[model samples]
Target: MFSLADLPDTIPIFPLPGALLLPRARLPLHIFEPRYLAMLDDCLKTQHRLIGMVQPQEGSAMSAGRLHGIGCAGRVTQFSETEDGRYMITLTGISRFRFSRDVTGFSPYVKAEVSWPDFQRDLGGEEEDPDFDREVFLKLLSRYFEVAGLETDWSNLEEADDELLINSLSMLCPFAVEEKQALLEAPQLVDRRQTLTALMDFTCRGGSSAPDELLQ
Candidate 1:
């Protein structure tokens, strides 16, 4: 297990319902709200201005919002302050964090003390499978795309690594709140991919059927 002591002190915290971040990928955030602005200020002053991206259970602002247990910490690699005092920030994920507890007495954004797991990444092993399972996933994803009438760069998507592909799709896909939470709480890349595959299959089948196969 990865220790909390190893994490950088004073990490950045982004608290929003239904948003998830995964490691080794980048997420762009538009920051205009006051609490997040205050968070940006606090991060800029610290040595490790890294931020943990988490989803709150309740759809409220800082007050009365409950954070989910899992999150990913990212470093602000690129940032631009807009003319209107808004910030367009790019967060590049560093590691996945499990919430140890929440830190209070700060601004609107809630900070969590976290612990991480020891994971080894094999960056060169990405591949496209033409088997039945992969075919089903692809077909489901296509249906999802058509249903939502969304356009994406298929070529670039086909080239993404497993973690990036699954997590990015999970974040952007029009899935339910519980479904998104499931994707966020999945322990590893393999498990997450499997869960996503199941979700896609169910969605493609057009059923709100119980996720019996997946939950098992």
Candidate 2:
């Protein structure tokens, strides 16, 4: 329930690779690392309880590396602490942000100054993709799944709404880190769908030989 005016200029960030959190989508995280566990503790102490989910650039060490320019900020909606000193939480995406600059601090986790103007539309309700061709996309998805040796409940996919279906696939698909960043930075639902379709098509056409091979 955060308005644009309510978001802070600085927030703690979690730089994870191959993880995507779209607006209104939920992401579950396991917080075990000492630093991240400290991050969870700090987040719970704040009113917004927002955490920025970003990706480290490809070919860079995950512990210390440059991050992608765009990322989503999620609010900690569900949280629980296990007996073994670990934290489990679910983040519901709030808005997408553009990275400004890293905020140097004594904290163990990374913090960044971010701006949210470009993705103001993300603050709205679920988006629509009227031009999405569900039948064709499903056919491609089925073929892609077969080639990748993955399985899913077609009935569930068929019943999902456009936003749910597309966002979930964009998040869950085993795309490369850069590809996931592309999906995260895509301007709109239609754009993401096209990007996703192209990626699946690429994978279906024996494009998996190189892990670094990206969609053109």
Candidate 3:
């Protein structure tokens, strides 16, 4: 369990469209840009070692882009710096937060005041979601993979626990920004599962009326 006290009142955000992180999920990031490299340095020096992973809104201007309001905060766990000054870091997520507003002038990197009430449940370990529709999820996933011509280690996927399987697939799947936001904002694990189902169904069927799956 993460202590709320360890998190800062505000967090510096790294906004890369299509990249995402979720509570308890680990995301590998390449930090080559000067601003983010500086951000990583400050994190290593200060105890405020959490970075908020967010996405710039699709089709938005890169120079002065708008970000999706919700993002997950990740704690720096693995870090290594290359001779060329680039940093390869892995962030293990701590919790999800909603942006209150952007606050600037404190750092070269962008900063945002954020609130965590929506994701307090994330501080605790994820319990097995009784309502998870594993059969449907797998069926749609298999079909989606077939459509995309993507391959997976089926044996490894089968061995994953409920939380790992869901989070892993959600991260790996190339769902649209709106769909990804739906997964992040789901109120509970079961809800996220349902949202994943909807997104997968839409993607696999070319955004037609959602294809129905056998319910068990």
Q: What's the best-to-worst order under TM-score? A: 2, 3, 1
The 10-residue segment of model 2 with minimum total lDDT is 207-216
Query: How does each model score on TM-score?
Result: 0.80, 0.95, 0.90
lDDT of 2 at 142: 96
**Which 10-residue window of candidate 3 scores lowest in summed lDDT?**
207-216
Q: Give one digit per residue, the lDDT tens place, for model 1 in 30-99.
A: 9999888988888878766688887666454543246666677877888999899999998876676667
Q: Please report, in order, the local distance difference test score of every candidate based on alpha carbons.
A: 0.68, 0.89, 0.79
User: What is candidate 3's lDDT per residue for 1-216, written digit by digit as tens?
Assistant: 577666677888888766778888899999998888988998877675889988677677432258887889999999998999899999998999987888868577887899887777888886478877677778788998988789999989888889888888777787666566667777777777777777777777687333334111
- Per-residue CA lDDT of candidate 2, range 1-216, in tens? 667888889999999888899999999999999999998899999999999999888877655358888899999999898999998899999999998998998999998999998888999889999999999999999999999999999999999999999999999999888889888878899999988898899899898632343323
**Using alpha carbons, what is the TM-score of model 2?**
0.95
Off by over 4 Å in 3: 62-65, 208-216
Q: lDDT (0-100) at residue 37 of candidate 2?
A: 94
Residue 48, model 2, lDDT: 91
Better of 1 and 2 by TM-score: 2
